[model samples]
Target: MNGSSALTLAGVLVLLTVVAVVIRPRGASTVDFYLAGQRVGVATNAWAICGDYFSAASFLGVAAAVYATGLDGAWYAVGFAAGFVPVLLFVAAPLRRFGEFSIPDFLGRRLGSEKVRLVAVGVVQVVILSYLVPQAVGSGITWELLVGSGLLGLSPYATGILVSTAVVAGLVAFGGMRGTTWTQAVQFLLLLGALVWLAATVVGEGFHYGDAVADLSRAPLENPAPDGGLTSEQNALHPEEPAIFGQPGARYGGLGQFALIVTLALGTAGLPHVMNRYFTSPTGAAARTTTVWVLCLAGIFYSLAVMLGTAAREIVPTAVDDHPWLADLTVDGVLQVPEHALPVLGRIYGGDAGLGVVAAGALIAVMSTIAGLLLAAAASWGHDVYERHINPRATQRQAVLAGRVTTLVTACAAAGLGLALRPETFATATASIVATMVTWAFAIAGSALTPVFLLTIWWRRTTAAAAVAGMATGMLVAVAMFTAGLFAAGGLLREALVTPTLVAAPLAAAVTVLVSLRTTAPADVEKSWLIMHGTAADRHAERLAQLVLDENRRRRAGRRARRARG
Candidate 1:
């Protein structure tokens, strides 16, 4: 890494640490630590939500995917943004209305069963840990490329993972939801700004977006594998073999394409960290509006990302002859590591300053997302498990302390796993290792939590027993299929099993419905539905009633003082 780039990257991290210190939550209440005192506004929360959702995968992998494959690569962004539609339609409002500390907390209370909460907690941890490892790994990869050296007697990769994990985890532990929210909001703006700056530079430097896509589409899409030579099934499926900028069959086959889309779309409705952010909204309506804003922001961010990828494809072949680093990583004029597509573009178009901005955005992407994941981890294991089960009578201070401890422990575990990986895996493919780990978390969350969550909120007949049974069935089946798929040879069966939500989700929903039919409903099932479906006006009324009760207590206290004076 160049001195200018290292200084820029280090400045951003220092600024974030200052932000964390400034906004860190105070007091020992769980409310302050866990949900930011439930006062986050729609715009602020929306940005934070974007920061949480757009991990290293979105910032790097999407563009890389597009750079390598003509039209098929854009699916990553499309499927990811599509997920919020389900969140807005089915989950955002209801989930906020039915809110607790986290997903598991909501489930446990809604079903009137601790067992259901425990099951949800386990599933959520699996999702969080799976997601956290990649963010950590991505941090290491970014550090190696942008900073080029390690500190504290460690390898660059190890230093990257440990430092990022420690800093973000400490932010969460100290500032909790409040500190992370503001930091994430800022991080997201930085990310969007980086994309916009790079886009403007590339376009201004004589790259026409439409012409680039049009020209690339006319030829058969080549695989951007490190070793090369994978056939384009997309071209074979259609005899004309016309170049299209937005067609299927680059990395995934026809069915594989649909499966990936469905999994990603449905998966958003169940992600632990994403939904946990909703709980920090001031009202259910705030959460709903936040989703709308997220859609807009994501649409803008991802469209730019795809365009950048297109620019890289058009610009890199010639630029490689000029930059020695580019030539070393390229195989036959195509980059061996697709993720380098953007950084190379930055150096080619905007020089060292541009490279620094893109590199900082990557680190921000990893750290900001990790903040939300660690917070969610604390909510599940610390608030939901340690406080609820182990110390039911624990004080508020004790509860918050538990959350802090969990944050540190979870961060360490994920960082250690990240240090074990080879950074090359994250840099090369369209379906890079970082992206794949995120997909596994998504697939598992979709199978185990989404069906039961939707049913609990919208279906009146969803019993606690049914929720538990359905969750168990989903998790077991997903794992079994995932294991089998790993062992199977590459083909349609492998593709379907590797990303198995299309099948697993339906099976989970079926099991939930069948079990619900045979079981007795909770005594307050109707009341739960009312809470889940309550309007904004109803929530206003509830808050107004609480205000009246507080006023009444003040008047009574005033009268008691008068009597004492007499």
Candidate 2:
């Protein structure tokens, strides 16, 4: 990009960083560092949740999926948005009420078992690492494409990976959750703004989304089919598919594929980084309200992304000879990189500067997500591991320091993994696989933890043993399925094995109920239930409102007194 463009992007990023760092609450307490002192308002918390949730996967992968697979690509957005519904109904309020630092902390406390906590921590770490690496990789890919900068003979990909990793690590280490939360919330707004602007511009340029879809539907899709060249049979199955859009059924088929979608949608409630955001809110009600906001924002963003992807398919000819970038990268005029479609659209509308903006946005999306992930990892390691396990008597300052160190270490590890994996696949493909892998994490969390959490808050008879057994079984099944799918060849068996949440989640819930029925309930279960589900949160909300009013009244009174004295 040009100097002015680079400066513009840098100026925006620096301004955001300043706001995040300066506005962070002054305190080094563990609660402040990890949960923003649990004082984040509903609207800010909602935006931060959106920032955490809308990773590189959502920003790039959704559009790329549509660009590559036609209408079928829209399923990613559908599944993603649908996942929040279950979360709102089942997980949100209860989790906030549970009041824990991390998922493992919540599980450990709820079940009253240190062993359960340790096991949950291990699983949560694995999930975070699995999810984190690909985001780092995405950051690298975006930088490489946008800046075309190669340092020390390194490719743009390597440069991107290093820069993003360092930046995110620094942000987390210095600002912690207080800074991270505000930064993420602002980042979410920027992402939404960018998408809205791009969408409007594209529409203004006469790119009709509905007409584009109709036109794409009427053409033949020429894609890389499993058995080589697109056969007549494949075309017959996807008659309405356009040449730019891949053939239907070429991706996957039957119940197994549907299971993937279900797993992803249902599994979202369980993600540690995502679930942890709820804890930042002051009360259960605020968490619930935040989720409602997230649902609305996500729905709008994903819908626009889907439309943009469809627009790319309609506007950009499949044949590379027709476009400038395609000739440089494609063989025989066919585009190979699916991820480039969105950037290409930006270039077509806003030229080089627009392309840089979208690319920078992609980078910001990754960085914001990585920052959240790192914080969650820090909480898991610092609070759950070091403080709880190694040094029970450690001071709050000690815990915060440990979290900062862990954030640095985790970011470095993720960067190494990103570099190692950068050449293996395209950014879009890697993002999907990472997202899919985390599906098991979500499933286990939703199935095992969500039920126990809900019942703990609402029902009085949820035994500790039931909670322990449920989380254990859920984790075991998800791990087994994930491992089996990794080794298994591409087929029906693989699809079934790969996306285990569809099968494992239900099984986990069943075991939890059955085990609870067999075991004697904890004596404190009723007390805990009341604490979790009672009106304390409502009372807290009323108190906060009264405090705001009182403050405002005092300010006005002070002004009157000063005037009278003068």
Candidate 3:
């Protein structure tokens, strides 16, 4: 391990801990613990959401994908950014208007069924766990590369999984939503700064993006073979042609591309952690406004990630001449693992210090996302399950304790799963393993939740029974297809199986519609609709806040006048 890099990583973690402790909640109130008292401003919530949303997948996997697969890999960024657009248009305002601690809470209340709530809780857990494990794996990968040292006799990768999970879980347990919010916002800024610094350094080093792409396209893409050597990649889409670095057929083909995009695009609305953040907005309008800022910021962030990925592809090969250390990480001129693209680029550009910055950003990315996921899990278990079912009359303190306990348990489970995966064995399994794993979470979310979520928000006749059927069907179908994808041949069939959102989402929607048509609508449908879609509540809240501000200003003025007269 490099001392400078280790020091930088330690410093970043220390800063995060300080922020969490300083901003931790002061009360045992569930509102404060779960939703930050619903007072988060638009700008702050936007940044927190970006922090939560831009996981290791966005920071490491997106760049890695681009470096490995060229243009086709860029679809990850496009699909990710586009996912928020639907949230801006359909989910943001209405979700906050009908506010609750978690997605299960909202759906349970909306459908007026204990059964629906339980089913939603289960689905949310599945989505959260799927998303959480990949983040833990990403932490392990980053740690193995960054520090290369282990504690307690564990491997470097295992140590990272346990340490990051434990640290972030403890922070979430103590800090709750309020603390998590501020820290996430700050962490996002650090992440963005690191990316910007890396990009600037690359460009300053005389790396022209257009020239790089053109030059790479002239030669076939190569990667590390199974025996730890270089081999030319054959185009999956057009086997007759060489897999070029600037072309489309390197990673995905026609069907695979469409399926992957659909999975990511529809997944954002159903991500329990991301959707949970919306509940922190003071008003539905604020939630909508926050989404606008998120889109702008995400665009800038992903564009930089793509550029850096290209920079790594072009610069790293030539860099081996100067940095002999890189010879082990690369086969010939090609990187063995795509996930190393950004971190390697940082080291190339700024030496050990640069690597530390990029590595810290990556760890922060994993931790921030893990924090959000844990909170979401806590809300699902403590609020939706325990408070609503096991102990209806529980006190505020009891509820908060339950949430904390749930956070720890969930974190442990994710860490355990990460350790089981043993990423080192599959280091050559895919170009961007983190991205691939995250896509599974997206596929599940899109298939099982997104369709039903949209229908419940927009369709007044949606019933609890319909929701249960939709979620169960969507989830089962998607998981089954994903399992089938494991042994399926590599082609359009595997693409459809692996990324089944294209099929599963529509099937879920159709089932929901059919079941709803056959069943009677909920008795309080009109009331729920008004709560979800009307603007009167938002207007009244804004007016009350304005009056409070004005009253405080008047009191201040009067006090100043009296002091001057005295």
Highest lDDT: give the candidate number. Answer: 3
By lDDT rank, best first, the candidates go: 3, 1, 2
The TM-score of predicted model 1 comes to: 0.91
Residue runs of model 2 more than 4 Å from their true location after superposition: 1-11, 224-250, 318-323, 331-334, 423-460, 487-491, 536-566
Looking at model 2, report the run of 10 residues with the lowest lDDT sum. 230-239
**What C-alpha RMSD separates each model from the true structure?**
5.0, 9.1, 8.3
**Per-residue lDDT over 299-355 for candidate 2, one digit per residue giving the tens place of the 0 to 100 score:** 998999889877876766653445566555433432345566666677667766777
The digit string of per-residue lDDT tens for model 3 on 1-566 reads: 55666547646664764575575555579999999999999999999999999999999999999998898889999999999999999999999999999888999999899999999999999999999998999999888888888999999999989989998999899889999998899889989999999999889989898999999899898877888777777787897887988888886778888888999999999999999999999988899999999999999999999999999999988989999989888888888878889989988877788888898899989999999999999999999999999999999999999999999999999999999996546555456889888998999999999999999999999999999999999999999998898678677888789899999999999999999999988899877887888779665775687799999999999999999999
lDDT (CA) per prediction? 0.82, 0.74, 0.90
Candidate 1 wrongly placed segments (more than 4 Å): 20-25, 223-247, 423-430, 536-566
lDDT of 2: 0.74
TM-score of each: 0.91, 0.86, 0.94
By the TM-score metric, which is better: model 1 or model 2? 1
